[model samples]
Target: MPFLRNAWYVAAWSSDVSQTEPLQRTLLGESIVLYRDSLGRPVALANRCPHRFAPMDGGRVRGDALECPYHGLRFDRTGRCVHNPHGDGRIPAAARVASYEVEERYGAVWIWMGEPERVAVTPLPAFDYLDPQENETSTGYLLTRANFQLSADNLLDLSHFQFLHPDTLGSNQMASGTMTFDEVGETVWSRRVCRGEQLQEFVANAYGVPPGMAVDRWLNVRWDVPGLMSIEVGVAPSGIPREFGRMSYSGHFLTPETETSTHYFFAFGLPKAMGEAARTLVEYAVDGLMTPFKEEDLPMLEAQQCALGDQDFWQARPVLLSIDGAAIRARRIMDRKIATEQLEQQARIEQCEAEQGGKTPMPELTAVPIDCSALAR
Candidate 1:
């Protein structure tokens, strides 16, 4: 999969790579070792040593360097082989291990898996209101074990919440309501209006919502790409009549853990869950509700992958209503990008062959500097 073309994927949270520990995560089938250096900056490196393939994560962070567990190979933040304990301090050009583009934003750390040279860390995603440093935010991560798109579909499929989270997070109202879509360049924002009791109360809590409100505010705007979202939810007070009120926004991120799995990151807090305190009381309740919803999703998505996995080329199933204009647009965009990337690769190979007058080995892609911050804008 050409996931690197223009997609943004989260590597780890800022809290993940503590100064005391090295975190290991696999992306696009590559194992990476991430850790904070002496200055508390996150760094990434391929989790292997060039000599005998020792797993680097087994090593410890000593001073500003990460030393390999096996051969005592030491690499700096840029993945430069700084010292070979066995061969004095001489560093060779071939001694360098592949490193990824790394950046910190919105209290999380991101590492690109594609050509590190082409990764741009400039455009990190935007959060609506819940500031990581200020709000009573809670953090959690899940390994989907399914295609990232399946998880995206799960998030985009809010209709399931009604039957899935009936007592807590579900909206009996949206059982039968309308869904709307607004396309933003390279990104899509979607909303579902489940007009009913709980939903009405939620709407009333809209920013500066009136004292006695009765309506269903747009609850979510799924950032239908691979960007993280910051959502602020305004819940109507408990005493408000069912006929009045609404829920504003709750933030989320759908990150691809692999082509087949995703990491669903979330934070819910401050006045949440009716009479009970949200940050304190609702945490467990929210987890309980989300746990089932997530579990219920596995079979459906896994089956989706199985149905299509064995093929050499991906096939598109017939589109339906919920797939909507945004999903359709996203697929089209992805297809175009994928095709362009392949064509570009082929062109490069053909050009290289022509230059050699015939059949010389084509050079691999050179890593381009990435501006990771651009996706947010």
Candidate 2:
């Protein structure tokens, strides 16, 4: 299974792609363009025109078809050129480009690069809060130099927040909480309510919680298909979930560019009663402080990814802790999925061979999703 080839990966925010036509993006290194069709369904296609090899994203949208800017060749969402200005009477049936399946959810556009026939939108992780009326949320997108896996690893761990994002969302006490992990329904949920004396002091100063009130900082990691992690964090009194202020924080990793570079999509939700004042404050803090903190993490991951080769690449465990279990389990699950996908691919090859009799040929493969073993070591 391709790490991101089959899953519903967000390409862009809804507002960014609604204007003119197909929006182009590089997920897992293949350039794809996304657009809404006549039936108002979103679809993706290989961004290049096979004829002259021009980018289809540069083309204009003419009704349902996206017209190539170079030759005025128009191809529909299925990547078929219905109208060719230079053609005699009819366009050749062979003149077409690769089209992909796309779906829009949670204010983002998702594309499928694997077998479009096998893509199922039902099992996709849906953000239910986006549908409800009581949530006040905003989406933020950023490109990072760190490996996607590093970011995934970072998000699953709440222990690093004290050092990484200390000023905004971290407390020295919560960083050393007794975390518990449980796996259910293809997802790993882990959480710990902070109780350290330092954390209690920080909470008292920040939120005016009583000195006796212990904060339950719950963090849930829903690993939707292997590498894609949906993280939710909430802070409430030791036993109460209702006092949760920041209700949700979800982050997703797009297919990597050069293995070390990644695009991160984030959806943060707070109570609507928090008002515009709170929203503006959050935005300002995230942009000014959080972004720079993320930038600080970039060099660490980049150096780690770079040191993998030419040195001892996965021959030893450098250093680890109990807190790494969340990331460890996440990797184990991904490894299993990748192995299953490889087995299925092999089975299909054998089946095709049995049909035609004799030598079996490997089918065309798209992106290489994730190499799970690398994370284990």
Candidate 3:
């Protein structure tokens, strides 16, 4: 569970947090409560109260601060204890929770679980296509009982779709499709093209393809660090240029809840130029196709997790196939990044201890940003 803490991870959708109540979610194994302040800006803080260790989510939002349900101590947006109804109303210096940096964009609230200083430089993975003003978008969340990497692998290597989702999103053409993998800086790209085949009924309808028509279908996926992916799927008449085809864009943002669970946020979008009919088609695909596909994927992922219980993924010695190239590359990249961060952190701690003449208190970690501008697709 050595997460790339310097990167941004989706905490909740914009619609999930409101000014009236706090939303509790666990990310990177830490309990975080999210709520909007008086001005309707999102706020994220450690969920545990400093006094009685009560969860802040159980308390009510009082303007820009959250009132502790246990003893009525109030914590402000900066996580400072501003109101103490106890004896003398004197707040202890330690009566504050850790506040995390958060940003609201592309209809999701992203949290930085790592060093605060790096937040300014580590820009969020570009997802401008998800802006509602430019495109018709629908989002959904699924809590999968599986490692975030496992869920990520599922998206990176889509060969499983032919077998795992034959009825909705797959076909024999998928296995025979031409696939390629490439890396441009920190981003990983996987592309597949199937020629002269009819897509699944719902998929064809979503792309405005006529029944029984043979088309060239393409699936292209781009992966950013720490499990952010954008997928483009399109279909064109056999011999036509892909630019003239019907296409849809989707995003998959994975945030680990723990070593064995992940918070999956996904969105499907179509250009507003496609009109209301395309919007309705996207909604239908979400409800009719994606919903059922989730039903199929979750159980399989959970079963895989149960099988690998307590054992590391590499320690389990999974057999790799040609289809696994993209997934394996992504795993190696993430592993290297996490290892580097850990080493830098240890060095800083050692330097601090040496300067203090003993093992004194450790100072805040200052992380160097990992530039992912090349990963923006």
Candidate 4:
């Protein structure tokens, strides 16, 4: 599975990277080291040192630079080697590592893994609800030994909740809900609304609803490019407006670590306007909601991966279902974007080669763009 490289991927929670120690993580199959500079800004660089190809994470931070453990070579935030403790103290021009564009926002450190020039045009997806100052938030991470798309598919289709998370997050009414799919700009949305259903105990407690009370429940998920999703779940008294009821918003950001593994970064947040009581509910939401995901979803996704084993998802010939519409739409959107990017990259390479008097001339690429206007909302 070719990844969409020209995009922002969450490398880690802002709290995960520190000024004292380098945090190493694999994103899009590349080893990256993240740390804060002396001025308290995050920096991301290739984890391997050019000299001897040693891992740079083993080194210690010295001011705004990282001192290589294998040798005393020091690299600054821009990935340029500032000092070479070896003979003559003359730093080789090729001693530096690749410096990645990084931005800290929405409580996470986002890294751009594609062309540095493209970073100016590409904007990070806004996740304002995750701001800690305005919302009571809880974050959790889990490494899944499954393809990132598979995990994303699980979220796009909520029907599985009825069977996979019966006790914690699902109910019989959920499967019978009316589902609708649409597109808003570049975002794909999947919405399920279950009316006149008995509130599950876990949900009732989170929303402070009376147990067993029949309410209108909604599960709305919006997906952006490169596996970023925001899920809005709420329940309200029958025939009542949703704003008058309790709602919780959660962000599910998935970054592929490899073809067969993913880095799942998820966070739950509730408006502080819901009062101090909402803070307590946010804690319960984390513990109560994460139970099914950690115990049930994780195992199922991993087992599914083991079953597929190096085979492409479509090659496995999955049976089609109405519930799979949203996931399939997203998969197609991703496919088109990746294909377009690859073509553009090839065109650039060929143009460069042609400039150098290569035999092959640069071919004009007529890539097909994704048309979502028909489904636009």
Candidate 5:
């Protein structure tokens, strides 16, 4: 899969990894294992052990070290082999595994599957709603069998809501409203404003009004490169200012597991002032949003993937739609970024060759393929 290698991708929720339980997941086609160390700091490493290529997640955590289940070899958070129960306690020079830079913030564990130097300066997408003081949010995770970009495309284009989520999120306003698309730097956003229209029943409930009430509503969605989208939705009495209305920020964070799968993390957040009653309503709203996703979206996306077979997305030349502007912009941004990275990597390789008198230097290995059948024997 051609992915943005220099970007931060979510590995798992902070609550998903623990000192006792290790999380095994694939990111950008790399197998990653995550767990909190003895000191409660999250650690991400290549899931395979060097000795016999056993899965590190099959082992147990002892102190800050991960012990291999195959032969009891142990490795620490830095991916250095710390203990070897055999061979006179002498560890092999090449016994270490790969370790990824990890950051635990915004209620998720983010893994930098890129160059370590880039990880320090790479800014993560702001999820202010996940902050404890500003708002309360209900989060859910969905594992889907579709490329991450497909999910992003689904999100950036809201026109499909009329048909896909007819009962909960769709309305005549979404179909008839004038939509505007804009791109600023690496961000692409789309806005739709409807005046004096009957809001969707789900939106009306969240707005603390009757289901059929006519109101002014705004649906503003922003898309950042790679996989971050934030949607702001608000509704109020016609001609009333937004400050006096009910609003929510719905966040979507998509992380690619492979070319064919994704880890989708979503949050529906409302202000703290909403109180307990509003919280209950938000829960209902979340369920309402999830229904179309699980029942309608997932199956459709899976079928789309099946139809594509092994063909790349752009290779298929998808039919352009009026609502696809934002999604297309996002795809272009990502494509340019990926192309730039490929050029940079080739330059580094050429530079290494020049420095070494036209000989290719030994590249650092991030992972090794082992024959599981041999290990079984």
Candidate 6:
């Protein structure tokens, strides 16, 4: 998939993995099986069994080890095949699958898909509001039949909300709102402000504001590399301070399952409704936000993917609109990062060949940190 492998990608929600059962998921075109050990600590490993290539997740969990479904070969959390059922109980040294580094944070399980040593250096993208003890969060997952980057573009350019989610999230004011975009390092920031406009029906309902109230609305989208977006949408009385407004945060985290498939993890947060029922608040927001995504955005993106086929988005030559500024910047940032990595890999291979006196060694990829200090804000 040529993904940014050295970054942390969301594998699943924290609640999705179980101690007694295994959950299998594909990320960055690799099959990953996630399960909690006997100690209830989350673990991620390659889903394919080393011997028969059977799915490990299809098997049962024996204490902390996962048994292969086809055979009784058991693999522990470190991906070592500990128990060999047949043939004198002799386990081959090669009978081990790759184990990925995983961390449970921000209500999500993040997996590092690259060099194990580099995992600790690349910090997880922070979302302080996702803490369960202090904030109420309801997570929703969608397996979209479109490239993950397309979903990133869809969220970065919120101008589509005016048309794509007209009944729920969109408004004419949003389309005509004054927008400004800026790029710092690998992160993009976009802000849109609309003044003296009637709030959208769903927005008013979600915030418990009067329907007919004239309000000033602000939408800010912060996009980090490899597709993690945090959006702040707020509205207050016309001509009032925006800080006094009711604010809600929506997280759009995209993990590539394949070139044409994506694992979408989304969460809706309302600060005003923190004391209210979590299910009620989440259901209300999901009905308003996710409904349109399922009905409208999915079809559009899927059709676009079909039309493009195997062609890259830039190669397909999509016409740029004014609203695409932030998305375009993000695309360019990713392209640059990928290109840089490739160049470094080639350089490493050449150096290895030179040092080995004309014999080429397998290239070792060194993780380069994408400057994203501005993204966390």
lDDT (10s digit) by residue, model 3, range 235-318: 999999999998788899999999999999998877788789757966775677556557899889999999999999999999
Q: Candidate 3 vs. truth: CA RMSD?
A: 5.6
Candidate 6 lDDT, tens digit per residue, 1-377?
37778788999999999988899999887789999989988999999998979888888888989889898999998999899989899999989998988898878888887667777777866677676666777788888999999998888888887888887777788789999999987779998998887767778877667978888989999999789999888888999898898777778899999999999999875443456765577667766667788889989899888999999898888998899999999989988888876776666556556655675334344443322332222
TM-score of each: 0.79, 0.82, 0.94, 0.93, 0.91, 0.91
Error of 2 at 88 (Å): 1.4
Highest TM-score against the true fold, candidate:
3
- lDDT winner between candidates 5 and 6: 6
Give lDDT for model 3.
0.87
For candidate 1, the 10 contiguous residues with the lowest summed lDDT are: 367-376
lDDT (C-alpha, whole model) for all candidates: 0.61, 0.65, 0.87, 0.86, 0.81, 0.83
Query: Taking the tens digit of each residue's C-alpha lDDT, what string does model 5 give over 1-377?
Result: 57787887778877799999778998888888888889999999899998789998988988898888899998888999999999799999989999988998777888887788776777987878776466667777898899888899888877777788777777776777778999999999988887777767766777787866778888888988689889988888889997898777787889998898889988777677768864676577678778788998888788888888889889998999788889999999999998888777666655555655655434533222222233223
Clash number for candidate 6: 0
Model 5 segments more than 4 A misplaced: 359-377
Local error of candidate 3 at residue 161 (angstroms)? 1.4
Worst 10 residues of 5 by lDDT: 367-376
Give the lowest summed-lDDT range of ten residues in model 4.
Answer: 368-377
The Cα error of candidate 4 at residue 276, in Å, is: 2.5
